[model samples]
Target: MTDLASFPELLAGYFEIPIDEPGAKAVSDPYGSVRVDVGVIRQEVRSPGYLVSGLVYDVSTGLVESVVAPTQVPTG
Candidate 1:
């Protein structure tokens, strides 16, 4: 995992699903209440809305598989 020590420059943003609570099981989750990891934990002051190039990680894993980039369009 990359060091988030620099912040903003290292880890720009984060976002997540609106589950009932953190670590809430998805079994009871509604359709739109699900989202991937790295919820907007930080933001870049300089870039405004641009997510810092590469600053994300999965806490729910011992080894991450992939990162699903946010899309302007939602999936069906």
Candidate 2:
């Protein structure tokens, strides 16, 4: 089973294509597909680490939603 805790990292990596390649549009997984909107990625700094968040437009529902919580990586 896929651990729920790893979803943030999984989603963060899944968005890599669209983030790197400007021409990229959509992506797919076992659940479904979503249109990547690189502009929505948000980042913020916290005390012990930083958080990066992003959202995707669902192809089926046509609604934007967060696939995972902001990924938090400790700096120390």
Candidate 3:
């Protein structure tokens, strides 16, 4: 509901990592209640030549409720 400006700080606290070290790759809490996946794509023809993305999943519901990328963030 907010913006990416606050995402790193939030993720860091939830994962107990440094703000600059969210380790945004595939990660989940010890209890498996929350899961996060960071995705990257590379293409020579693309505008930026690459892309970075993230997804937050609810393990219990097996649903992806949030998605974030360098350009946008959409929640369900």
Which number leads on TM-score?
2
In order of appearance, the predictions have TM-scores of 0.19, 0.29, 0.28
Find the number of clashing residue pairs for candidate 1.
6
- Which of candidates 2 and 3 reaches a greater TM-score? 2
Off by over 4 Å in 3: 1-48, 70-76
Candidate 3 per-residue lDDT over residues 16-50, each given as its tens digit: 77888764533334212222333223222244434
Instruction: Give residue 7's lDDT in candidate 3 (0 to 100).
Output: 74
Model 1 per-residue lDDT tens digits across residues 8-75: 32222322334323333222222212232223322213334444222224466655433434433322
Which residue ranges in model 2 land beyond 4 Å of their true spot?
Answer: 1-27, 30-49
Candidate 3 residue pairs in clash (backbone atoms < 3 Å): none
Quote model 1's TM-score.
0.19
lDDT of each: 0.31, 0.43, 0.46
Worst ten-residue run, lDDT, model 3? 30-39
Q: How much does candidate 2 score in TM-score?
A: 0.29
lDDT of 2 by residue, 1-76 (tens): 1232234445446555433442233233422232233223322233455565565656688988875556664443
Worst 10 residues of 1 by lDDT: 25-34
